[model samples]
Each structure stands twice: as structure tokens, then as C-alpha cells.
Target: MESQQEIKVIKSSGKRAKFSLTKLRSSLKRCGADDHMIDKIVNSVRDELYQGISTKEIYNRAYAMLKKEKHVYASKYKLKKAIYELGPTGFPFEKFVSTILNYSGYKVVLDQQVEGKCVTHEIDVVATKNEKQILVECKFHSEEGRNCDVKIPLYIHSRFQDILLQSTAEETKPQECWVVTNTRFTKDALQYGSCVGLYLLSWDYPINDGLKDRIDRLGLYPITVLSLLSNREKQFLLSRNVVPCRQLIGDQFYLDHLGVSQERQEKIMTEINLLANL
Candidate 1:
């Protein structure tokens, strides 16, 4: 117990680092868990910590505790993991971003073919607002702890530049290229993206306006975050392009298709309404 302070946890990157109480506490706090609940969860988690434990295990333990307290807290705490649930493919993630941009008042189109200066490129998402057009490239990784490296921005910047050079490109209205991801950006990725003027959004980058910030601010959580839905159920919804919890709120008949019981459906929608009304 005395040596618990020195315990090392394995990250998804296979790197081991000393566990920090501050980091764990901050994450719980972000989920809107108050000091009292935070203290209880933190102490409980600390008591269970052992050397060589993985971060995933720590998160699962904490998430279970949070869920026991409040479904809303647990849902929000699971935001990052829920985003991961968006994909075995990048397409669902792209649709997820398009949905967010749409809620933010942008007209969004997905998987568009645009002619660049040299070759035609398929844009993951093209968002337009008030005559401003933004081309978004989404990078989705199925695994955690994989950060977007400098090479990503470095490579995408060239394609963006080519599109910028297109004389016949549509609208041409103050086009901006954005790179969005569900993970963190490497230091070089951030630097290169900034230096090249490419808009970058990741889990926690850009301080106040990262992907997580945007999601929390908008209360636009993915349906995958719902606690009662099994993985099979979530995948069924995703296959039907039902990504946002708000969207599912309108069309929960998908729940019926899965043969979910009326009682279970009520419980699921209760959780969704809590998030939707957040």
C-alpha cells in the first residue's frame, strides 16, 4: 500500500509511466463528477492500483464507479471511448463529424469528389457556412494511444494545397482545410498543422475547442455512448447511419428492430433524454 504511489501503468502505446493522481482526478472532474464523488472514486481506484496495470483497466474501474453514481456522469466519462466505438472504419467517424458540423450550423456533405490541381480527391467532409467552405479530413484509429504524427499533416497539406490551386474548383469561397482526429496530436503534428495553416481538431488539443470540448459544449454525444446498448446493438445503429443520440431520440424504432424490450427501451431512452437535455 505504501508503494502504491510508485505504481507504473501501461498506456495503449505500450509505454509504462508512473500513475498520477492529478491526471485521474482531472478526468473524473471533467465528467462533471463533484468533489465528493471524485474523492471516493479516486481513493477506490488508488486502492486497487498495482504495478503494470494498464490504463484501460484503470478507466474501466473508474467508469463502473461513475456509472453506479449517475448515468449521465458515466456517459460523459465514456465520451472518449464512445468516439472509439464510432469505427472499425473511418466512414462512421466522418459521418460523426459531419453531424457535429451540421449541428453547429454548417451545411455538410460527405465523401465528395473534388478536382484538385493535379488529381481528383475525395474529401471526407465538406462543410459550408455563410459562404465559407471547409474541407475536412478525418483520421480514425481503432486503437487508443495512437497520436497523429507530423507526417499526417505534412502529407495532407500537400493535397489541400493542390485543391487550393484548382482554378475550376467550386465556390472557392475562402476554403480552409481541416484535419480532425479522435486521438491526440503529436507535438510535431500540432506544430506542422499550425505552421501550414491547416485547422486541426483532436481529443484535447487547442485547449478550449478540441473535439471533446465541442462535443461536450453541444451535448452532441454519439449513440454509441449509451450504457444499456450492447456492442451488437450499437453496430446495428451505426450501420443504419444512426450516430447521434439526438437522432436516435427521434428514431428509436431501431431499438424495436433489435427486439429490445419495452422496459429496456424505456431505460435506454431515459439515459438518452438526460444527455439530450443536457
Candidate 2:
């Protein structure tokens, strides 16, 4: 048991907390790591521990160690931070949502303005699967601690109702509404959603069926998770709408256009191949 004075980690929120090997080990386990791999990576991270280390630094170390052991698990290990890197704004998040929905057998329309009974509302995404139509609102928070609250559900419910009222029977066929976020939902928000039958998808809500689960089930990771890229590079790629590593797999022209140096570009492609198993 290391005391708080022994080691500290700077969190993504810019807050500091005492480093705990237990917590790190638990996180690896949650990422579906096996016992043997978990022990090895935990020991590796422990050996490199120091006071005032950034959580990102600790994570990268663990990720590198884990990647050598199991590439898929290593990719999943960075899920949380990868999600955070999806935004300073929610556009990338929306694109991610679209991708997930598309993968899930839904035809998706992004950032469309649909006419409600009273007004025209700019819907974040519209996903239609078979005969079921889903209106999706993606609520993305850049920071970890903040969550989607009751007010958001209430607001979305109103818009959903408005859309339901305005649309023809054919247009609203088997309609549903979903609010998805990269973080968790507030207690009240979850409660409200349950009461209203509004589908809510967050990072860890609904047990094994949350956003992370859905992403992992399909192995549809965002481009931000590429460990070889820096924050600035990731953001730049996102800004240009290059939001999936698969998009860069064989596209050397795009890499060159982005001005990624030849050596670094090779490193990135190699990493993407490992993560995507391409």
C-alpha cells in the first residue's frame, strides 16, 4: 500500500490523485485482460512509477507493454482516454455515433434539419434500421467528471415529441429516441430516461450494453486512440474529418497531405495495422 505522499498521478481533468496499483490493475481487468497479462503489465508500470507522473504517461507505458503482449487488449485499454480525445466540440463524437449506428445495421443521416410540428430542429443523427427509425442526440463532454444530466433528457424528449407529432405515419415508422454520451448519465437523467422510455447510451450505463461495450463488440475504435499520435496530431486529424485509423491504413496521399513526416507516418501506419489487425 503506497501512501499518497509516495506517488501522485495528474488526471486528464488536471487534478491530482494518489496513484494506486490496485486501481490500475482493476482497470486492466475491466478491459478484458487475462490474469497473466495483467500481472505482467501491472508489474511493468509499477517498476516505472514516479511521483507527479501524468496519468497519460502511466497509461502509455502500460499500453506499450500490453501491446507487445496482446494488441487487441492494448487497444481496448485506451478506450476511456480515446473517447475524451474525441472532442473539444461534439462533432467528432457525432461522427463516431454515426459510425457505430452504421455498423449496427442502421442507415444514418448526420446533422440534418428535420421539421418538427412547431419548428425545424437540427437533429444530430437519424438512424433507420429495417422498419424502426431512431432519432439520436449525442451529448459529448470533453472532461471526465461531467455527465449528461436530467435537463438534457427533458429537452430531447420535448424535441422527440415535437418530431413525432409533425412527421407523417410513414416517416415516423416504429420511431424511437436515443441520447448517447461518452460519459455516464446523472442519476436523475437515467431515471428520467427510464420513465420516458428514451434510450440512453453512456460510457458505462446499462451494464454490459453501454457505449464502450457497443464499440468494443464491433471493435470500432475512433482514430484518436492511435498511441503513436500526439494530442495535437490527433486533433488535427479529427479537424480534417479523418476520424478513423482505418481511413489512413493504405492512404499514403492523405498522410502526406497532413504533412506527417515519412518516418512518423510509417510508425503510425504500423501502429494502426497492429490495432486494426490490417
Kindly give the stretch of ten consecutive residues in candidate 2 with the minimal lDDT sum.
269-278
| 1-278: candidate 1 lDDT, tens digit per residue | 64777899999899999999999999899888999999999899999888899999999999999989988889989999999989899888999999989999999999999887799989899999999999999999989889899999998899988887884646674379999999989998998888989999998878989988898888889988888889999999999999999887889889999999999999888888888664
* Clashing residue pairs in candidate 2 (N, C-alpha, C atoms within 3 angstroms): none
Per-candidate alpha-carbon RMSD to the true structure: 1.6, 3.9
Which candidate wins on lDDT? 1
Query: How well does candidate 2 match the true structure in TM-score terms?
Result: 0.81
Query: Stretches of candidate 2 above 4 Å error?
Result: 1-23, 29-34, 44-75, 171-174, 261-266
lDDT scores of the candidates, listed in order = 0.90, 0.83
Per-residue C-alpha lDDT of model 2 across residues 92-143, encoded as one tens digit per residue? 9999889889988999999988888999989999899887889899999987
Superposed model 1: Cα runs more than 4 Å off: 3-5, 168-174
TM-score for every candidate vs. truth? 0.95, 0.81
